[model samples]
Target chain A: MNIKVAFLAILLMALITYIPRVLPLAIFRKEIKSKYIKSFLQYVPYAVLGSLTFPDILYSTGALTTAVCGTVVALILAYFEKGLVIVALGAIITVYAAGFIL
Target chain B: MKKNFLYGLKRGIPIALGYIPVSFTFGLMAVTGGMPVWMAIFISMSNLTSAGQFAGTYLILHGAGLLEITMTTFVINIRYMLMSLSLTQKLSQDMTLPRRMLIAFGVTDETFTVASMEHGSLSFFYLLGLITGPFIGWSVGTALGAFICSSLPEALSNAMGIALYGMFIAIIIPPAKKSMPVIFIIVISVLVVCILRYIPLFSSISSGFRVIISTIIGAGLGALLFPFEARDNNIQEMRE
Candidate 1:
């Protein structure tokens, strides 16, 4: 691998990633009280996960669907307030199974 | 502080595992695209954002302008702004600026999710878990991927290459079932993205441009159309 290119890539990635983390906090501070702005933050995780989910599941590795299956199993198991380790393992099993089967 | 590092790793590993392949792909692509492996690994090490690396590599490979690259990367990664602000609240009050800045480098979707789940007295071990796993995974994966892509047959790799998307879906779907609001936001975002992607005018644009427009527009629209008052009140009320 080209060390220079890789270093450049890492530097660039760090810079890009840092922006989203730094800029908003620096700029908005406490001013993020608007209902719309607040609401946007609230729903962000879900929106992100959602957009990240389906098409990839459908078209990607089919493991997403499998992982979804695993996650569902996890959610059901989650009601017991099972520790995250158990839940994660459960999903891992589901992933292997899903990848193998589907 | 040691505890925080360990905690970060524990939480970071699963995320790291997920990130490894993605980074590996980046590594392979970088070398295949004509960049070196050490440089790619260094890139993975420093610039932990996946999309940015992918975008940058592509731009460089194609000889795109620096301004375009910077603008493109900025747009793609703008979401971290929100994650960081939320993270500041979560960090221990004792956290120094330098500490915060360093730890901030590890802020990622999975890491942030795991961190956000913390109740109190932030676990450095958790952060360590979160960071180390993904960091190692991404780094090692990149190194190995570059090696394999260079050495192995193409057809098999392509066929098995679908696992990365699977990981993403795994991340997206589970929480969605529990939250309608998130699901709604996602659907809207996807639909908007799909629409924007296929538009005659937008179709000519590169992936970088498309991602910029679609994410900003989708996120902007979701913020506008969906009022999150109930959710915010709940989190703040719970914290109090």
Candidate 2:
């Protein structure tokens, strides 16, 4: 690997990455006085998570039916607010079982 | 009595468990991309960012530059800075600036999401509990991935991949089912990401750039159009 290239890539990425991260911290250091900003932070996590999920069904490699089933099972479990371990184990077992069948 | 390390271990255990597979996957990806095991461990320990480590490894393996890696990972993690600032307000409005600066690096997406919702002052000890879990988990996971990945079959890996996406779906669907705006935001973001990937010009941009751009566009548009908010004051508090 090109060490210089790698170094430069890391530096630039760090700079670009740092700005957005730091800007908010610096900006919001004061009480997030702006109602809009407070509101934005409030739902950004969910919106981010939501955006992440919708297409989780499509992101998989296996048969749609199996993958979809695994997802449905996880959703049902999460709906009950089960912790991460339970949800993950639930989905993993479902997918493995489905994989064997399909 | 002297403060004990076991206290840290106890609290970090849950996060450490989460880190196991997640970091393992990161390690697997790094090796798959041709990095050395030591380098993989170094990245995991130093960066402590699962996604950033993956992206950095991909860039390295693909023969990208340091500039590119740094710029890309920085952008992706910018959200954490916002998290830190927001958390600052929630923190014991008295934590010293120096402490905030030191702890800020540990301000992750999950930590921030967990910390922000809780009521009352934010303490370093609790954060230490939260931080140490993933720290050891990720470090060990990366090392495990380096050594253990080859022994693991591709099928198992693919199946485990389901967990990441499953985790996402788990968080989103519950709230989305209750609210229309969230559904709209989710649909819009996924659609935009798909379009960006499929459409000719947007596809030309770097993958890291693609993620950063998509998040901004999606979250910005989400904030503007949907403006979905909850009194998660109670729900968020429970996690902390």
Candidate 3:
């Protein structure tokens, strides 16, 4: 990529990305009154997290077996209510070890 | 305000740690693919996005037009609108327009998740502090990867791939375990993602759109099936 072209592309990408993030926060100043909407907003985080994790996590380590091993370790640690760092490190370590084993 | 800011900074440590490997990978990919190191760092610093930056950089490397890059980034990042909207309900009353705009820039999936899980309304300082660490981590990690490409062992870098997802699991699973509605939301979302991901008919849908669609269905069904009580929905009351 030419430096000039890359700069334009990066600027365009940044602008497009920033617009979605800024628009909602800019436009919706008042609290939404609808219970349905509120409930939906409340659940959005979990839904997004859930959706982002599966299928994607399975492919994160580039191998199905290692990814599954990492995921199971993460799930178990998370199930046991481990801290964020612990669950993450556990999964990483598991994937590394499993990569060696399998 | 200072206390909240520091608390948020402390809370952001894990998220910052999680971002390092991912951004490092991004840096590695961009540089390895012939993108200038400074450009990779600039993208990380300016965009602060994972998927969008990767896709945009890929297209740029392949000599895609500005329009294509713009459209692709817009599609990938459209999910942030939902996150920002959801956050509108959580913002503290003191949030002004400038502050809101600044905070909005930091609303990545991980930051949004952590912020949304807070017990009460979000203050600007807290949100600012929350964003600071991850921002630094992302840029610094990218710089390292760009400068030190191929030096890190493959095994370690590959293993680090699961760290962010593991952090996501850590965020959602504990709450899901306690609440039936949360479990339903998670299960539905996961199921929706699986369907879109595996079904041949849905293969054409991009990954970014897949996340947005799954989120809407899962959260919409959850809202219908388990509406919050007036007490729970009342943000003002909770703030007090």
lDDT of 3 by residue, B99-205 (tens): 99999888887788789889999999999999999999999989987888646566676787777678678778887777899899999999998999999999987
- Badly placed stretches (over 4 Å) of model 2 are A1-29, A41-102, B1-13, B29-35, B50-75, B90-97, B109-130, B154-179, B201-203, B228-240
DockQ of each: 0.22, 0.34, 0.51
lDDT-superior candidate, 1 or 2? 2
Off by over 4 Å in 3: A1-17, A24-29, B1-44, B47-150, B230-240
TM-score of each: 0.62, 0.66, 0.63
Q: Candidates 2 and 3: which is better by lDDT?
A: 3
Instruction: Evaluate residue B121 in candidate 2 and report its C-alpha lDDT on the 0 to 100 scale.
Output: 67
Clashing residue pair totals per candidate (backbone < 3 A): 48, 24, 0
In terms of docking quality, model 3 is medium
- For candidate 2, the C-alpha RMSD (Å) to the true structure equals 5.4
Prediction 3 TM-score vs. true = 0.63
> What tens-digit string does per-residue lDDT give for candidate 2 at B1-240?
013334544655776776787677567656644566777787777676644555566667667545556655654454455466667677665456565555565665555665565567667666656577777787998899788756767766566555655556555666667766566666766776667677897767664455445556666776687553443341242121
- Order candidates by DockQ, high to low: 3, 2, 1
Candidate 3 residue lDDT tens string, A1-102: 699999998999999989989999999755556767767866776777788788788988889999999999999999997766678779989999999899
lDDT of 1 by residue, B134-237 (tens): 77787898888677667755443333333333333434445555656556666786776566566786677664444455555565677787666553332321
Q: Write the per-residue lDDT of candidate 1 for residues A1-102, one digit (tens) a residue.
A: 344554454465567667677554344444355777666555544444344333433443234576467656555544444433344345445655676678
